[model samples]
Structures are given as structure tokens and as C-alpha cells.
Target chain A: MSERAQEGRTAEGPTAGEGRTAGGGHGTGGGPGRVLVAVYGVFALAAGARAAVQIARQFDEAPLAYTLSAFAAAVYLLLAVALGRGMRRLALVACGIELAGVLIVGTLSLVDPEAFPKATVWSGFGSGYVFIPLVLPVLGLYWLSRRR
Target chain B: MIGPLATGLIVFALVIALASLLTTALNKSMGTVLLVALGVLEIGLLVQAGFVVAALAAGEGPTDTATLIGYTAGTVVIPPVAAFWGVGERSRWGPAVIAVAGFAIPGMVGRMLQIWQGMG
Candidate 1:
């Protein structure tokens, strides 16, 4: 973790300078945008932590669900970083993938509960997560479009 | 782990979160009050972390020790990181970020309790 923090600090060094000059771009620099990015970051960490635990401890119990959990975590992370960095197009792409993932996974979980031995981040549109998964991408898309 | 202590931690976090949210909604830049609120909350979180670690060492926690410890450590770290970002931004969004971090602590603590109780 310390190593990762060190790497992140070094990586952020140049980008932070670039961000200063990139001024007034589509980055999530303001209040509402920062809130959205914060939510995305929270979800990323939550899903990623859950996936790590599930995979590390009980992979055999629900391999597919755990794998999907990992995937959702990755998508959340990508969207958060891209939006934070002002990569509007990349954020858009990530949000599109997230929306599709939620819809497809949510529907599949509902249609055949047995298909998922355990719940993933997108299960039932993230009911366990207060349905944020169902709504976040829509909000992301709206915010991205407005910023554009 | 410790019932009343956990409740105290959550309530404190929520109060700070609400205060931060109010600042953001009112379009105020992050202020001394907000920083003080966050500082208090971080102290509470660290105390909670200490209690959790002691309880775990006493063999009073979940079978999944790694995950439980991860959550405990994560909760303690979040406030400082959020504070750094919030203080750096100097915009309304700075408080917004702090609000998110503030809200997140309670949720993480709730989950940690669940994990400690073997609810997973």
C-alpha cells in the first residue's frame, strides 16, 4: 500500500501540473462534478474490496459472481479516474459500459436467480447497494454531456 | 464491536457529513468549521480503529480477519486523504468531497460491524 501511494504521488506529479494549464476543461473540478466523482470512487472501492474478499476466500462458491464483481469494480474505477482527469470521452465510454453491465446483469439476476450463486455489484441493479448502480451511469452520462 | 462506541462513531460521522453537505449546498468554500468537524471525526475514527484492533487481538472478531482489518484501516485513512483533497481544492466541491468521505465512514463502519459479527 505504501508502495502504491508512492507510485501514485509520483504519477500525479506531472499530471497535476498539466491539469493546472488544462484550465476550464471538462474535468470534475467543481462541487457537483466532484461529488459525482466521489460517489464513483466510493463504489469502486466498495466493489473492489468485496471482490477481493470473495475471490480470496470463497472463489469456488460463486466464481461467476465474484468475477463479475471484479469487473464492475474495474469499470467503476475507470470511470472515476477518467472523469476526474477530464477525459470526457473515456468517461463516456466507461459509463456506457457500466450502464450496459448493470442492465444486463440486473436482468439476468432477476430472470434466473440460480445463475448467480452469490450477488455481484450489479445484482438486481445493485439492490444491496441501494440501487446506486442503476442510477449512477445515467447521472454520469448527464453530467458528461453537460460538461461537453 | 463495541456497541455504544460504534454508535457514537457513526453518529459523529453523520453529523460532520451533514455539516459538510450544508456548506457545499450553500456554496461556501471549505472553512475552519468544516476542517474542525473533519478533524474531530478523524479522531473518532482512529479511536474506533484502536478499539477494533484490540478486540480482534482479544479474539473477539470475525473469522475473516484480513477483511475486517482492511476495513478498519481503510476507515482510518479516508479522512486524511479527503482532507488533503478538500483543503487543496478551495472550491465548494472541496466540502462536497469531504461530505462524501464523511458519509462513507459510517457505511464502512456499519459494514465492518457486520463483518465482525460474521454476518457475511
Candidate 2:
């Protein structure tokens, strides 16, 4: 499957393929990139909607946690857009922030449970999310680094 | 939402996901059969969503309406979007996109079930 895709690209010449697909290159949001973008897009929607609702209904309950949720969503959204658009620098930064967020928030939620009245996406290293939140950033970084 | 219907949807979607993965592994693109399968999944999701709405309207559901609505909406929307995204690729990864959607639906639907059970 991948071999054929590579052949198609080579037959078209690198520049021609890039021009035709636009950002639809492996380094960007084509092939496996599409899967990554889809996952990130889902996370963005999930976290963003959850944060929006929490903030609207009861911001007083856990302002910091909801704010963090919103922040995480924003990062995921940025990463999705960056990867889709083939903006490596933007994707890299977003991935870095995501990695840092899950780790720091995960540890904080654990080491000091009282500080978090409610859970954020990063809380417990995204245990509530089956650790996808913890793993996604690392995957994003690896993908970006491997991209040509 | 209806319990058996939701659980059945989850199982069916998982099967479809595995099928999509098989297609990808076999170096095939997204085919009409898979698209129709996705359409079937979408129909099931819509039915589940409709039930949720009906239950909520009669005040026969959980107190966490906000989360419930959020998840329900997500479950309904993902399949079509994934289908559209998958169809655009014209490569093995096209079905891989479908595979992702297939997996996501079960998770979201299962969450809806849990929330509906008032376990949260």
C-alpha cells in the first residue's frame, strides 16, 4: 500500500505531487497523516465542547480545570490544523505543549488531588481518556520528526 | 438511548473497524461496501441519537444533560466526517480513516451508555 503511494509520488515527481495534493503529503495530512489529523480533530472537539459546557454551566466549580481543558483543546486544534496544512513548526510547538500539559497536569492532579476539584484532560495523565491524551503528543512529535 | 441497540451498534462498528483495518492491510482503498457499511453505522447512530432526544424531552434521563448531549452529538457526527475524509484519500489509508471512525463510535456510544446509566 505504502509502496504504491510512493511510486505514485515518484512517477509524478516530488514537486508535482506536492503541488497537486497541496498539503496532502506524508509529512503533512496525507496517508497516515489523515488518521493523525482525524484523531487530533476528535480530541479538539471533545475537549473544546466539554470545556465550553463546563464553563458555561458551572465555571465556579472548577475554573482552573476547565480553563486547562479549554487550553488543551486549543492546542489539539492547532496541532490538527498545522498537520493538515503541513505547517511543521506550528505542529511541533503544539505537540510540545501537549506533551508538557499531560505530564504536568497528570502529576499535579495525582500529587495534589485537592487542587483539582474536577478533572482536566491531562489529569492523571489522561487516565480518564485511556491515556490517549498522554500518548498523542509523543506520537505527534515522533511523526513530525520523521516527516520529510 | 436504547441499551441493546446501542450495544449492538458498538459491536457492529467494531466489526466494521476491523474490516476497514483489513482492507488497509490488504493494500486496498475504501470501497463501496465499506461506505455502505459506514452508512449503516450512521443510521444506527442517528436512531440512537433520536432515542436520546426523545428520552430527554420526556424528562426520563440523567441530570448531566450537558455531557450527555455533548457525547451524543459527537457520536452522531464522527461517522460521516470520517467517511468524507476517508473517501478523499484514494489509498490504503482511506479505509484506515474509516477504521479510526469505527473505533471512535463505540467509545463515544459506550460513554453515552455509562452516562445514561447515571454512573457518573
Candidate 3:
């Protein structure tokens, strides 16, 4: 982790000057980063627990939807850990994956409702979560870019 | 659950949460008074939980036992977790965590009521 942090610092040397002018702090460990991490942690726990219970109870009902729930939960968990640990590379990768998942799943669910049969976290671009899933990845990406 | 009691508690929690949010927005440290208020809210939630359990024992129970238990457990867990994290930071974010937790409590309680009433 220290090595990665050093690499990030080196790669971001040029942007650091611009960042200071923009009121940016030390990477993704700043004040807004802390709050965002907390919120992500909350969603991770909530979505993971809900998916676990749903899959354990009735995996036979709609395997596709339940599996998607599990996938979304894993992504959330990974995003939370990446953000908390301040792993720039891992955070960027996870956030990108999250964005792709939400977009793909959202599109699939819309284009073919019968295939979904049930709603997952990313269904309709996370309508059930007040569209936070859609918005969070964008913020995550911007936060990462700012750190760079 | 008593409707009035639940509504009153929810309102109280909302007020507390909003106050906490304001303190954070002003970039102020979380003081002892806010901590005490959070303690009071936790105590109230515990009391409400006790009442809920008693009512269940007296045959006023929700249909889905597991979900109800989940909410009950979440209510007990959230406040302390928030307090622990909040105290650790000791910054404006500390009170912000409390604000989130406070808002969560009323939402959970409202869900519990809906579950009990078969509206969920």
C-alpha cells in the first residue's frame, strides 16, 4: 500500500499544483472523501446483507436477478474497501466496473423487462436507491481524477 | 406500536439530525451536548424496542419475523456505531455521521411500523 501511495504521488506530481489551487487535499483521504467513504460503507453493508438474505431464501425464484444482486453487492463491497484504503488504482477500477454494471444492467432491464423478472440494485440505474448508484461512480471517478 | 409515540420519536430524531447537519455544515466540532442528545436518542430507541418486543409477546407481532428482527437489530446497532466513528474523527464529519445515523433511525422505525401494519 505504501508503494502504491508513493507511485500515485509520483504520477500525480504535476496535477498536485493544480489541485492545491482547486482546494484539493491529500488524495482521497480528505474531508469529502471521508464522508463519501462512510456513505459507501453504509450502502455496501445494506446491499450485501439484503442480497445475502434474498439469495439464501429463494435462489430458485429468479436466478438471474438474485445473481445480479449478489454481483452488485460484491461491487459495492469492493468499492467501499477501495475507497477506505485509499487505493487509487483499485478505486478507479472498481468504480469503472460499477459504472459499467449499472449502465449495462439498466439498459438490459429496460430493453427487455421479461428477462429481469425481478429488480436488482442496478436495475433502472438504481432507481430504488434514489439513483445514487448511478451518481456515486461519477463522483468516485471525479474524486480519483482530482487526486491525480 | 403507538402511532403518536412513534411519530413523536421520529420527529425528534429528524430535528436532532438536522441540528447535527447544521453543526457540521458550520465546520464546528461535535460538543458534549450533542453527544448527550445522541445518548438520549439511543435510550429512547431502546425503550421503544422494549415496547415493541413486549407488544409482540402480547400477540401484536408483524408477519415477517426475520425482517422485523433485522430492523430491530439495526436500530440498536446504528447509533453506537455512528457514535464510535464520530468520536474517533472529532471533526465536522463526526457530527455528520451522527446526522446520518439519526435520520436512519426514524426511517427504520417507520419501516417497522409499516411492516407491523402489513403495509410493507
Best by TM-score: 2
Clash count, one per candidate: 0, 0, 0
Which candidate order results from sorting by lDDT in descending order? 2, 1, 3
User: B20, model 3: CA deviation in Å?
Assistant: 2.1
Q: What DockQ does every candidate get?
A: 0.28, 0.45, 0.22
User: Fraction of true contacts kept, per model?
Assistant: 0.37, 0.49, 0.12
Q: Tell me how large the interface RMSD of candidate 2 is.
A: 4.0
Off by over 4 Å in 3: A1-30, B54-60
Candidate 1 chain A weakest ten by summed lDDT: A4-13
For each candidate, the alpha-carbon lDDT, in order, equals 0.80, 0.86, 0.75
The digit string of per-residue lDDT tens for model 1 on B1-120 reads: 787887888898888898888887776667998888788888888888898889888988789887888788878887887787676554566788888898899999998889877896
Predicted candidate 2 versus true structure: per-residue lDDT over A53-143, tens digit per residue: 8999999998999999999999999998898878889999889999999999999999999899899999999999999999899888877
Clash pairs (backbone) in predicted model 2 = none
**DockQ: the better of candidates 2 and 3:** 2
